[model samples]
Target: MLITIGIIIGLLIVAYFAFVNFYPSFGGDVSKERQSQYTDSSQFEEGKFKNDKDVPKDPTFSEILSMTRKFFFTKVEKGRPSEELPNHTVDSLSLVSYHGGTRLMWFGHSAFLLQMNGKNILIDPMLGEVPAPHPLLGAKRFNEELPIAIEKLPKIDAVLISHDHYDHLDYKSIKSLKNKVNQFYVPLGVGVHLEAWGVPQDKIQELDWWQDTSLEDLRFVCTPAQHFSGRKFSNGQSTLWASWVIQSETESIFFSGDSGYANHFKEIGEAYGPFDFAMLECGQYNKLWPDIHMFPEETAQAGIDLKANVIMPIHWGAFKLALHSWTDPIERVAIKANSLGLPMIAPKIGAMIELNSLLANHQEDWWD
Candidate 1:
């Protein structure tokens, strides 16, 4: 009986390894050369990337079991919209042809198509229906359709990725977008996954935190974010996570990619303050992971920290990644932003936003 039990344990270990290794969605391993590249980054140490601020402490076996019980058994109220969300079709022609001013379009959540300085750039373009590796493993996206289908998109000049989480760095979306995109800019060690998915090494440029690179006249700076990274259970923090600072000759913008409340926002603001617009994560938060994802009020404060003239709450209105009500994030954030006299635009999923006219396009309470 003891020998049989030992054999079962051995089989289970083999199965776990096989699933993570063989699964394409789990992403690729960082090569030794790539690991060597990370050695210079202050954030990379002991063979994994890290946040400078404190993150959640590792849970004990009992604590893990308790959280697992709550996750599987607890009933969350209004976790998703009761009906399909209203959305607008993408004006692909205008998007492709326009060079008059910098325009932005949110494809729900953190995904965006930023047209600036006569160039088309995609930021965290996770257009997949489910955020998980498999369709059955995650909830369906609230909106049934994207503003513009992947096939309908025009040639992309560049793509900016913040991290390698499945929700942020989707495999199917990358596969569909790889050919259309001219270049991919990702955080350190994230290129391994893109390369594994068939993107050419030459097309992928990886940067450490505070690193800056340019595409034509526009500037892209990889900034810090207080978050962890991992697609599989075993490989947590193997890659780096970051926010981004995008600047054109005329306008500067910030994208806060899944960060908790930290001084990094203030630091970024001081280094590159007075942004024209800011898109910040404002959803999928809970007390269980408070160190990683900020609450609604914190999102408002982050906008202030960035010294942004206009802010839009993102990382919500798409997926039910947290137990909060579907509209809780926007509702709570609106109150905080209003009290702070901060200008925020909460547009519909596919609404076109002209950066210069943000105040005029102040979105109504559509989520209500």
Candidate 2:
């Protein structure tokens, strides 16, 4: 009887490890494309980037364990039921003029399509069923229907990614979007995943901190952000994180990718700020991971740090990544921004927000 019990226990442990070992591609050095993206670390160590089980576990695993325990064992909060989405159809809104003006349309979460100087750019698009490859883990996306399906989007000029977090760069989203994107502008080492996922080498443009590239009248500058990067546990901090400055002759826009409170905001503000409009990170924050994601109030502070005239809080209203209520982020930020005299745009799931209109009359409480 003892031998039978031991044998059963041993098989179960083996099966668990096997399950962990086999999963969505880790984008590690496997395929030829992935190998080509590898940079020698002299400091490089083998098995530095892969899924969680094989990598160095977090130093504060106890904290993560405690949090997970509380979430499963104790956390039981209810979300207030929102109004049923109004009956509507996607509008065929024609472009007014791209002479020198800029406009932004949110697709919920951090996916945005920015039109300026007759070009379209997408930022940090996590358009997939789940942020992670598996549906069982990671937060579910907020709006099941994207603002517009990727097929309906106009010809895209460039795609900007801030980091390699599952929430920021999704594999299925990239695979679905592979052939359509004209150029992929990413930070150093992020090209590995894109390459692994089949983006052509020529299409992947990797830049370091403070690097700038021009596409017609607009320029994209990769600036630093106070954040870390990792798709799997093995590669924590192996790649760079950043914010981007998009500039044209008459207007400038700042896309604050996922970041924590860092003095880097001031540096970026000094370099390419006084922006006409800035899309800042404003949700999925918690005291546990405070260094990576900013709370609602800090989102406002970040706007001030960037010298932005008008700010639109993003990274919220899309997915429930933290323990807060669905409306907590927007509600809290709305109040703080008003008190601080900061302008904010609180649009619905897929509303078109005109830059000129936002700068003119700013009282569209569309979230209600």
Candidate 3:
């Protein structure tokens, strides 16, 4: 009986190793050539990119064992929505025809369609059904359907990726979008994955933190976010993670990709204040790793720090990456926003949110 148990355990370990190694969705490595490009960056030391602030210390072996045990044994009933999440379908033709103003559409989680400066921009578009390299490895997305199918999307001007995490930068979505998108703007070291996935080198522009680039009238500034990145276990921190400052002549927007509360928020506000809208990450958080993902209260504080005219909580209403109740993020953020007198909006997934009307049409609690 003991011999049989050992044999089964060894096979399981070998199978898991093979799956991670052989999976195309695990993405490509950051080559030595790519690492060379980041030599001048303060965040790049030795080989891997480093966070501006110190991240939480790596979990000890004992902590890892405890976490693994708890993860499999713990009962988590409220971590996901009970029923299929409702989402509105976007009219692709109308979206393509839209002009004269800035509009934003949230496809749940961090994926967004920003129609600005007469251009269509996608940010962190992880539109896959699951947030892992394989479907069976992670929680499924909450919605049955996306607002618009990938095939139905309008010609994408640019796709901005924050990091290479499966939840933020999906391989399947990238493969589908590469042909449609005119360009991709990503953080330094991230271009390697796109290159591996078949994006033309000319169409990809990689930037280190604090670096800014312009495509026509729009300016994209890669800024810092306090988070870690890795698709598989071995390549952790190989790519950069960032928030972004996207500015048109008339309006500026801040996108907090995924971050914990940090002083960088105030620093960004000081540098580029009075943003028209700020999309702050506000979900998939827990007390065990509080320094990596912000709690909902911290989300409100981050908005305040960014000096945003209106704040829209994102990184929720899609996937259950943490142990909290599915609706806890929005509920907590709303309470904090009210207390702080911060203007906030939580639009239903797929709603066409006119940038000017964020404060006026803010009270729809569709998650209820």
- Tens-digit lDDT string for candidate 1 (1-368): 99999999999999879978898888898876778878999999888888886575677899889877876677889888999887989877877778778888899989999988888899999999999888988888998999999888889999999999988999999999999999999999899899989999999999999999999899999999999998887778989999999998878999999999999999999999899999999999989999899899999999999999999999999998887888999999999999999989899988889888998965788987
Winner by lDDT between candidate 2 and candidate 1: 1
What shift in Å separates residue 261 of candidate 1 from its native position after superposition? 0.4
lDDT of 1 at 157: 95
The lowest-lDDT stretch of 10 consecutive residues in candidate 2 is 47-56
The residue-by-residue lDDT of candidate 3 on 1-368, one tens digit each, is 99999999999999988987787888789888878888999998888888777786789999989877776566777778888877888888988788858989999999999999899999999999999888988878998899999889999999999999888999999999999999999998888888888899999999988899998999999998999888887888899889999998889999999998999999999998889999999998978888889999999999999999999999999998877788999999999999999999998889888987777765878788
TM-score of 2: 0.84
| Model 3: how far residue 18 lies from native, Å | 3.0
Candidate achieving higher TM-score, 1 or 3: 1
The residue ranges of model 2 lying beyond 4 angstroms of the native Cα positions read 1-22, 28-58, 73-100, 359-362
Report backbone clashes per prediction. 0, 2, 0
**Residue pairs in clash, model 3:** none
Q: Report, for every candidate in turn, its global Cα lDDT versus the true structure.
A: 0.91, 0.73, 0.90
Higher TM-score: candidate 2 or 3?
3
Q: List the residue pairs that clash in candidate 2.
A: 41-44, 142-318
> How many clashes show up in model 3?
0
The most accurate candidate by TM-score is 1
